[model samples]
Target: MLNSWGEDIDINTTINTLNGVSKSSSSTSINTSTSTNSASTAKNGDTRSSKSSTKSLANSAKLVTKPVSSTSSFFGKFTGGGGGSSNSSNNSHNSSTGTNQASGSGSGSLTTTTTNSSEDTREGNDNLTIQKINASIGSIKGEDIKWDFWKLLRFSNPDKELLKFIRARKWDPNRSSIALTRTTKWKAYDHNVNQIIMDGEYYVFKNEMTGVMQNLTLRKAVILGHDLNDRPVIVVRPKLHSTAQQTHEELEKYVLLVVEELQLFFKEKTTTATLLFDLTGFSLSNMDYTAVKFIITVFEAHYPECLATMIIHNAPWLFTPIWKVVKAWLDPVVAAKVNFSYSLKDLNKFIPTEQLPKYLGGELDYDLDRYTPPDGTYDIHLNDKEKRTILLDQWRVLIAEFIKITKEWILSENQSENKKLWLQKYDLSQKLRAKYIEMDPYLRTRSSYDIDGLLVLE
Candidate 1:
């Protein structure tokens, strides 16, 4: 039978392989090692032989090598294609474009398009849309409530964030605002996300269930490196999972912890991430539907436009049905970010060999066991209520100033004056971010990245 990606497979052979029943005499059967230890491990659900077969299939897989023109196609398809004109155009625009101006309605309808000799017209439209969003927030009766909404969202780069919502909602400001507000409330009240960050739930769980948390942490997922576009790469090994291991609540908290850690890696340009799922040695024992559904919900609803690509590597035939079911749950936009990879070469198309892990045919020799956890000593001084309160009060002042300038920037008709206010707003936003960093050690627990010196505060 042929799988969705057009890969040929013998269902009977796959079943026999999973059952630890050898069929080496059959021409279609995968070549097997005669080692007793390998057979014993497969019988115990380790599936070493199946992993070998997956690697063999990956080596022989033939994939399309043509270039794709559409931005969605470049990131979405599993074909061994190059990113074409669309990617180059975006790169050029990012590098060369300066001040953006909105050409559409003052309400930020995103209906008009324009061109300029010196700037990308889309930047102007996006900037105008963001201004409209700011204007909407400015209209709220209570200044404290308006600033509190911004604080609840909890990340620097308001323009970049607002743009994400706008693009996710197809450039409709009204829809984006609704989506943004929903996320804000969900994170603040429903999830109590700030408390989760403050409690450092992962560490709390680790202390309680040392053996399970240690094993899961070392094997399940890690933010290893970056992809070609400098987006953070999260490496997830599903084969390490088992439904019997962790409770639904514990699993949810662990996933949230990883995501919270991921936030520290985001820059102005690199807001999205590449998720690489290594499916080698995967079997029925590894399936966790509840965990999968929760993860899907977290990304699709709360973290919109945050996935650059999701690479499913070396998936066995057994995963096909599960993938079909999973695909149904994904939003069409989220589904477009999914890609299948059959080999190391396939992965290299998105992540360079230098940044890729050595086990995945890359130069980086990453060892999760060697990773150091942060000690609970970095922010002890901030435990003083008075000190922390003063810093937070200062932040509120900065937020007030930022919102004030942003409103002026939006209202100004003079090009030069608008440009000046834009710069002022930009500077205030940066200061707001810097202040957040100064208070981060107090607000949240230190992550592994902090211990490893990978967290860039500036």
Candidate 2:
């Protein structure tokens, strides 16, 4: 079956798309009027669906596979990752921890307050999940897991890596372990994400039939500035994207490349990002369902809790029906993060006027051509491969030692010993981060951020 973009899609996917409304509405009904009225003061509001609307919505929805299904074929022949069934297990931890509450002041500022809460059971669950993740680390290693990138994340901040999966699965250790393992396998064996980073701006392919060379990074998405919370803002111009420009595989690679690049900007304090979807001049032809599904899968399964907010700006009436079905496919938590901005003032609430793009009623004049790294800039890294390999080997050894200490920390009963082991792990993680910085030149291609000295290596 052909999707809205006229791309051949699986028959089962088409069927699922047709049935999305029935399936999604049963669980969470999207009040179109309520949503529109809350986000925009436009008088022309309509909440009506006809048979033709259903067909169009279904056609658009075909770009999105079943959200909870594990065997979606958008990302090559991978049988896992995206959404997978969780395996449940019993937990015995009963400890309580302090809770931090942030209250907003009258003048648009936040005040933090910390208090001990006996009702807080998250700490105990977190400890149990960490122990479970540590135990499964050995079995999940090999060619399937991108050892270099995984080690980079583990050594940089092991707790943060573990907590992402744990929190995504709601502190269910078994499910978290399963999701983490599957994602690693998908990234390494299925997607070859490490190779994508290595390829960088050189990721291109020529269509033999068309005799046209297609660059994967097509300037459709650009990292402009930071949000109010200092999260890196990825502004996506869907109007610039078309399925005819590249093959699905190329599009997938481009999307993953952008995601990996974005991850580099992440800090300990800023773990998430804000996606600003500028839908100006967007139409049916601009929709790429496969790309959309792949993005959803990556966020929900692979990179959980990585998106702080997604602002949809200047959405036209044509997109309303598509969004109705699309929002239903999203996880409730993810859906909740979606916000609508009808005007420049609405956007300024999340991003400052100084950082906002000029087109979006802000002062920042961001040109994609200027923001993109010039040709041959990333070529310098090719010579550093040998140095990168040596550093990687060293990191492997350090990670091995860290893992041993991690196991000891998980099992240690003495509070003092636990604290000491934790400090040791932290020190090792910092060393790992340093090692990554040393190997960074060889591993990743330089972006515009590096050229302009905007990216500070910590």
Candidate 3:
């Protein structure tokens, strides 16, 4: 069931591999000298199946199709290039061996240009890379919706993060949570057939605490379908919980939930792909070292052969340090604010301070009173590299603290104690960050280091 290419193809693993296809076909289905008649029995979309006898082509070639039942699994569909007006034209397919070729086992080329397309739709569930996304498009499914085009098409636009997150979010557009799979449960004396639980893993909210207009979305899509060719694929989407009260405390649960869900997907794959997933919501704050280290563990277990790039939608300069901090390369940003952090800082050493950042001129102070609701916290303020600096340092410390706490939580099994709800609350993700602020002494604790201190020590 390999495509035209000889690459080691999968029957279900469509996680992160959709770069391009090899445009080469041999005398595929070159039938006999004469045309024969055959009966059509059944079909399963994009393919026809039945027991038929059309003689000559290869003297005899075998084709078989099982009866398609109401219940079947679909990995996903390819993205379709939108429709456009076309000049009226009539195209005909008349080969010198027309009837002769028609008698072959299969039909003609998989591609055909119509009013909708001027190019061959080389779209199937192939690998999706930067180059392929630029070349052409076809049956794009929810899981196949990617964000490599973030810079030019998306991030460059308004709400770039939101757009990038949506495109990068993965789902088996063909599959719905409304239907549950059949399962068998063990009984005391016998086994009973039961329906599987449909656990829809998702949640959403906006950050009212900031007083700025921002929403967080969380969703996870697990891909486990044999494609037309019977290759396996797995698609994953992390979570984001945005609320006016969203804080780092709530963010940790999303991270924990993501890690837990990913473990389930791994069990379904024989060997996994590059632990593929995306972040469409708050990239920097939502993404952390603990969350990242967990994914790196997945890559080590699953995708040992190749590299995996986890795209971050709308992650400004702040999120890049995640790469620096973890000492791993994975966070690929689509559209994010520029002129800050490690990436910009490295580039800035060559540039001037006045020419520093477009967003950091600090010329006008945004009215915090208007943007945010009645809260002691300022919704908007003048450009303070100091505040961002505080956030960055504390975040690093928080990541360290999270790792220690996470290990303790797991290892604490040997020992026993009564820790409060805050321990359950502060699992280290950002949405949960708010709950941290609402409770505990950590809220009043300011960063001990300053911007200059970070520069010197870092």
Candidate 4:
């Protein structure tokens, strides 16, 4: 099965006698003869294998590539196929073209002619009627929405003559909406979630300036223990006016529901703590769940213990959090060899306010959340090169420490002392370092996941 966004999902694992895939250990490292460990992934979950699957398409387009099953071929009573013409999109949407200038009404009703030559009748169990297809010019510009929607004016709908002008497309707005709403049908980057992966995802957030509506949306849902995007988990948009009807606590409860849906996806062989977040948009406005979300999730999963952190990166006020996280990553690392310390970002938050004044580079716009050094001054003065070295050192050290901790606590305590070979499989210190090294450039440079994690909801 494919997700709403065209992610192919496998759900049979849940229903069959079989269960999740068997998990193997990560590549281990030791001080003995040189040995290399490879990431032998299990089948129960997905790892991002299609690295280039989702190339960014045109700004005015999005791709939908789900393979429609026979049972679901006709969703909501209509379907469309064929490449569209965007240049002419404007011609069909001329708001002024309407016959009535003041009320935005046209003299003729819009209609659609079905291409199926054999089928003349509106056979489906729907309220479809034959109507004239009048081209609507661009009157309302919605993100990823290509077709000009018919405007329903209260004043015009009352007259009998105006009622004759109501003929519209034969397709349901909910289903037919994709023809105009889906922007790109590009090749998706296919990668199964790594059993031990550090991935970040985000959702697009939408809100009304009127403050009457606020909600999150995802094209598809990720099922647990399986690949999320292309699986059985229901992919749904948050209800309209959700913020008005939904409380923050209710949102969190649904978050837990997502976790439960994905419970089967994590097998015992996998031990990495991954993060998943929903990006609601760039503005939190009256909502105040930002800081609480971080404290309640993301950091706690990876800080104390867990594999690499994962995040579903979309939401309102997205820009601020990103600025803060990246800036935090830019703080200084203090060490014995360093006479001068450069800011690596994260540690800068905790530096005393008095000490903050001493640091050469400081970020004033960030929300330090009270860890800011008292008086906001610091004495450390490190160059860019020094800062880079400190960050590398901190990351590498953490890798080593993680392996050691896992060895002491995760290994079977009851195993015989002579049979220690199994412990080697779990010592992934060096391997972890290599993984970070590979991703560091992108993480610091592009922050590429931002696109997938965030949606521009107007």
Leading candidate by TM-score: 2
TM-score of 2: 0.66
Show how many residue pairs clash in every candidate, following the order shown.
Answer: 2, 1, 53, 96
Q: Residue-wise lDDT of candidate 3 within 1-458, one digit each (tens)?
A: 23111123242232222211111113221211111111221121111110111221111111011111111111111111111111112111111112112222233212222242321121121112211322222222222221111111110111111112222322221111001000000110011100000011212112232211122122233332222222223324344423333344334333333333222222211212222233334454355455456445333322222122222333445556564665534333211211222343442333333332233232223221121111323223213435543543443344334323322332222222212212331334332243222221221211111111210100
Off by over 4 Å in 1: 1-148, 152-155, 201-216, 370-375, 384-386
> Native-vs-model 1 lDDT?
0.55
- Model 1, span 1-458: residue lDDT tens: 54211234343443233223221121111111111011111112433433333232222210011111111121111111111222222211100001111243232111223265433443343344334433333322222223334554455566556556656777453355446645654665566565566656345554775543654456588888899999999999988888777777777767876776777788755779999999999999989889999999888777877899999999999999999999999989898989999987899889999998888889987775565555576647536656666666676566546544543443344656654655665677678778887767656666667766767765
**Ten residues in a row with the worst lDDT in model 2?**
31-40
What is candidate 2's lDDT per residue for 184-294, written digit by digit as tens?
A: 667765787766655555443312312112333356777779999999999898987778887777678778878877888877567799999999999999997778888
- Model 4 segments more than 4 A misplaced: 1-245, 273-282, 285-287, 290-307, 311-318, 321-458
Q: What is the C-alpha lDDT of each candidate?
A: 0.55, 0.55, 0.23, 0.24
Any residue pairs clashing in model 2, and if so which? 63-289
State TM-scores per candidate: 0.65, 0.66, 0.20, 0.21
Q: What is the lDDT of residue 308 in candidate 2?
A: 95
Residue 2, candidate 4: alpha-carbon lDDT = 36
User: Which residues of candidate 2, in runs, are more than 4 Å off?
Assistant: 1-156, 205-218, 369-374
